[model samples]
Target: MNAGRDAQAAATERALARAHGLANAFLASLAERAVSRAPSPDEMAAALDEPLPETGSDPAAVVDEWFERAERGITASPGPRFFGFVTGGVTPAALAGDWLASAIDQNAGLWASSPAAAQTELVVLRWLKELFGLPVEWAGALTSGATMANLVGLIAARQWAGRRLGFDAAAEGLAGHSPIVVVASTEIHLSAVKCLGTLGLGRKQVRKASAPGGSVDIAALATLLRDIDGPVIIVGNAAEVNSGHFDDIAALADLRDSHPGGAWLHVDGAFGLFASASPRLAHLTRGIERADSVASDAHKWLNVPYDSGFAFVRDGAILREAFAASGAYVVGSGGWDPFTHVPEMSRRFRGLAAWCALKAFGREGYRALVERCVDHAAAFARWVEATPDVELMNPAPLNIVCFRIVREGCGKAATDELNRLAVRAIQEDGRAFVTGTIWNGQAAIRAAFDNWQTTLDDVAMLQAAVKDVATSLTP
Candidate 1:
């Protein structure tokens, strides 16, 4: 038995060393690799799928095989010039922390389960509140992503509203009671709508308000709130997804205050909340502190690893009551149990990556990152405006440039089709990557600059690629 144990330990060490080497090689090659690769489902299945072996196999060999097979199929999202979905590149410090967190394998649910994980999360939450200019006393939790973060905040809002209506929402749901009114801008992200639906608030029943150019109309919101009497919750946007425009959250908060019934204000900042880190762009997030809850993605502008988000609530007790579970076996040290605030009971040590990022970058490092991305967006927009064949689709307020191809005597359908062709051509060319969106009812292309590795050279290359594609399609 001693001999077998020794062999197993040695085998594990060897496998880890091999994996480390493979990871380094893959990261080193990001600069020259294609931004994305098209791999068929059959190809992946053939390489990864097989019947489970009846006998044991060598661990090191298995790791090597998986890495080699998956390398070609991997997308270069971590590389520079990936301007799709407002994604961010992983920084060195954050990647190192992720490695350590995976090695430790801590379940960051309870204080007793992992003391370090729980305390680290608490510290990270405080740091995030400070960075985003949110109230420092608010309760926060690391979530899977913005979607889950939004859901958690909405859950708290729903519960708080139910309690106001004389029922414990956590204990008793709103099945046959008066329905709470949810108000949101038409331009709000789809994730917030999905959160409302998951929280038992009717998505179709939401009072759709006008938000011209991504800024919610305060007058329209006031009119809707005047009609809503009972429990109410208003969803606000810190930044719109397409044009990077910000809603007047401070004004929304004021509206909530003036309403007949005090309403819970939840803001979906997502990537836009990072603008608060920069002094120049901090003005964009004015009045965000007044929100009852705020949700943002750490993986977006924070340049951390994938699947990381944050949710902050002004009422800590309400947040805990909404999600905390009680059981005979469940015990807590009363020191920061994440399970009380987040939906998941078993979650990864996600706070490690965020902590590493904040510590390594500090305030100045983050400010520079946010400012640099905003500058890049402005520079790219200038290039777009200079190009006669392209028309700016929306105002490049922060870090997203929305544009579409234009030509003389080209109809709307033809122009949309040409832009679609341009998208296909540029993506196939593999120099840079972008996605399409509908801006003011016209098909437009969007270049979302959030990746830290994206430089001016990559942006120039992207501009040239788009021009070439447009020329080809128009000719």
Candidate 2:
């Protein structure tokens, strides 16, 4: 072998070994690590910023130095007590699969380029559909995250809507076409609004569908749909962010039927759709199968690594027409070409980790994981109500607990301030991590239990931290 090749191979082995050791150490320390310890931006920059060297350095040494610096800034999100958002911890199998994907370096953009990537992705998509109780035949693609997934689904909807209006929106653009009415509840996720903006359907043009407490008022939606004269797109929520309440999707599906212009039903199922994985929680996503398109995040509840999303469309032909690229260099393929269904042409091999995870855990394993998180949230809500100093802001419909601090004889403003202080204090205490939010116009602390590692002891620790902080801040 050439001397250069021999040296490179040895370097690669050493670098990989260093990475593996660092990963193991991090995972092992999660039990005792603080959920968060954010380093100041200036400090982090000082640690990581340096001028590029003219000469090559030892790859293994560089890896070790990077790990040491990066470890200081990492949030213990994979730990049991992390409740900041609907973030899921990576499973061992998923992490291992991710490593394999990088080692293989497969560009999963074209079917001909990597047949294994395409077929494995197809299998993973099928498994997800079955897990979520969606139709197995639905066309789906894995994207970077829910945002991209929502954009892909909305692109298809825009085209479908344009066709109903006797125009090809993809080719002709939205200039001469009749305005497509994008209807959404006020509770719809911000990502949906972003999707509309990205699709050139002005976000301001979205017709507000009045839904109180995250439940779509079917009669209100019907009246709005009845009056709409143009192509329609209705966005529904599988799980509302603050309360985790699910909209009546079946009712939304019925309204789509009687509309003047057949409405496109799209569900933003971000973290909530995982509820369907649990038999006890599946009722929340009832009639989700009726949606014309669905957008969800695998990174959130699937416990996969960052940046994995799913976009599913009932009409495969329409999805392909909306996104499929054509050029002399892009060869025709009988196999599944991912670029045909998704927005990206150069895609990462994200499906491998998701596939490994689903295969490792199976259906029953996921059910237990999801159900346990929901149960934890429910228990935390109960504890909040039982504790006189704290009050539940909303019913724990799924896996999010929103609560506020209450002080005897304190005014509303004072109480809100105390709750705000409590949140900040608890976060700084470094025992557990939770986020602050406003629920029903009141300042509140939100703990979303989605991490599979979280246990009852972790929940107790969170309760204690909040109680201590709130009591200390009380007047």
RMSD of each: 1.6, 1.5
Clashes of 2: 0
Worst 10 residues of 2 by lDDT: 209-218
Please, what is the TM-score per model?
0.96, 0.97
In candidate 2, what are the lDDT values of residues 1-475, reduced to their tens digit? 6999998899999999998898899899998887777678898898899889889878889888888887768888888888987788898888889999999999899998899999999999999999989999999999998999899889999999999999888888999768888888878888889889989998788878777776777888787887888769999998888879888988889888778668899999998889899888888998999999999998888999987989999999999989856989999678999989987888899999999999999999899999999999999999999997888887889998888888889888887888778777887788898888877678888899988788999999999998888768854
lDDT (0 to 1) per candidate:
0.88, 0.88
Once model 2 is optimally superposed onto the true structure by TM-score, how far is the C-alpha of residue 83 displaced, in angstroms?
A: 0.8
Task: State the displacement of the C-alpha of residue 395, model 2, in Å, after optimal TM-score superposition.
Answer: 0.4
Clashing residue pairs in candidate 2 are none
Give the per-residue lDDT of model 1 (tens digit) for 1-475. 6999999899999989998988899799888878766567888888788888899778889889888888657778888888877899999999999999999999999998899999999999999988887889999899989999999899999988988788877787888777878898988799998888888887787897898898999999899988888878999997988889998988999998887777999999998999899989988989999999999999998889988999999999998889968888887686877899988888999999999999999988889998999999999999999998988887898999999889999998988888887777777777888888888878889999988888899889889888988877862
RMSD to native, candidate 1 = 1.6
lDDT computed for candidate 2 = 0.88
